[model samples]
Target: MQNGRKQIAVWDVFVRLFHWCLLAAVLISFYTTKTDGAPFLFPIEVHAQAGYIIIGLLIFRVIWGVLGPTYARFSTFVYGPKNTASYAKALLKRQEPRYASHNPLGGWMVVLLLLSLSFQAVSGLFLSDDIFFQGPLYGLLGRDVSGELASLHALNSDLLLILIGIHLVGIVVHALLGEHLVPAMVTGIKRFTSAPVDEKPAYRTKYRLLAIGAFLVAAGVCGWLWFYPY
Candidate 1:
């Protein structure tokens, strides 16, 4: 409540941490796998480790989206085709309304990113470099199937870069439209001069402990896959 604006806690602690941690993991994965002549210190093993971290993060996020606070749920942000189209039209006309959670188009982007990253991580589990590195489930699918997944994994990495580019461009476009979107994600608090009409009461559920519990479960599962591989 500064200067007549209402400040609300939109992203929870787990969500904020998840967002940044995922970003870092993605970057590390890409740098280790995609870049040529990269540091010898960061080998393909680092890439595999980052993929495991991403798998754990995505698992926790799916759980949180189901059971976390009001604004964190998929129901709050995932709009349908008509709504997304309408929001796109509004955006082109510069008439889109501000949203406390993700705007309609942004919601779909989040879904796409999640799905894409999930595929990337899961596919990596079947990949191998004949000489030194092998994913946990590298030989489970047989060489032929693993080879196909390896190809898809490479293709999807390009798609991921494209999607990430669009995401960054969207942030810049929002900034140009007078909405500073990144800061809210960083702080987990969003401020508005007038609460958006669609904005719901924030933090209606006590999910902090539940979120932590969910992450531990996710991490344990991913850890088992990382260690056991069978």
Candidate 2:
């Protein structure tokens, strides 16, 4: 606390790393998938690799959401439907309460984004272009089933684009309200004019070891997925 402002840690290192990595994976996957033979586009192998990485990132995130720091834990941010609806109403009036962690609406958005990405990644595992590229699980399922999953995968990708657009719009809205949402995410620090003098202490533990272990497990899973076809 200094000069009538208190700096609080809102995102830990793992959370920040996960956020940017997932964003890059999603963007790379999108570009590769959409630009099949176009100039300056990555090969389909890159797209498939990105999808595998997304699977690992999602797995690590689900685990971390349970065992991570104060603001990173799912229990600290997820709210009930009633509370979410109330927050939505407040947003319409531009009077929503400022939260140290994710606001209620943003919490739900996070859940939706994670779920959407998970669906896309899983479905991609069984997809096939029938010409040059095929997913790792493409042979396990019959052609018809794989085709259906591929259709769903393409549809979900469109939904993901729409969701991303909405997320950007929300960022703009927050910016208009004088909240530096993007910067806070990048720096992991949120400054408050007057923080609680005796707020509950952060949950401290050997988080570095835990993060390393989780990352190793995720990487191992991804490696298995990548090489299982060979």
* lDDT of model number 1: 0.87
Model 1, 1-230: lDDT tens per residue? 89998888888778899999999999998888767626756478778888999999999999999988888899999998998899999999998888989999888889999999999999998988887678888888799999999899999999999999999999999888877788988998888888774688778546768987998999997897678643
In model 1, state the lDDT of residue 186. 94
Model 2 lDDT per residue over 1-230, tens place: 87878778788878999999999999888988677635534467788889999999998998889887778888878899998899899889987777788888888889999999999998888887777677888868899888888888889999999999989998899888867788988998777776532233554657888888889989998898888753
Which numbered prediction scores highest in TM-score against the true structure? 1
- Indicate the worst ten consecutive residues by lDDT in candidate 2: 194-203
List lDDT for all candidates, in order.
0.87, 0.84
Q: Which regions of candidate 1 fall more than 4 Å away from where they truly are?
A: 37-42
lDDT value, residue 146 of candidate 1: 97
TM-scores of all predicted structures: 0.94, 0.92
Off by over 4 Å in 2: 36-42, 196-200, 203-205
User: Which pairs in model 2 have colliding backbones?
Assistant: none
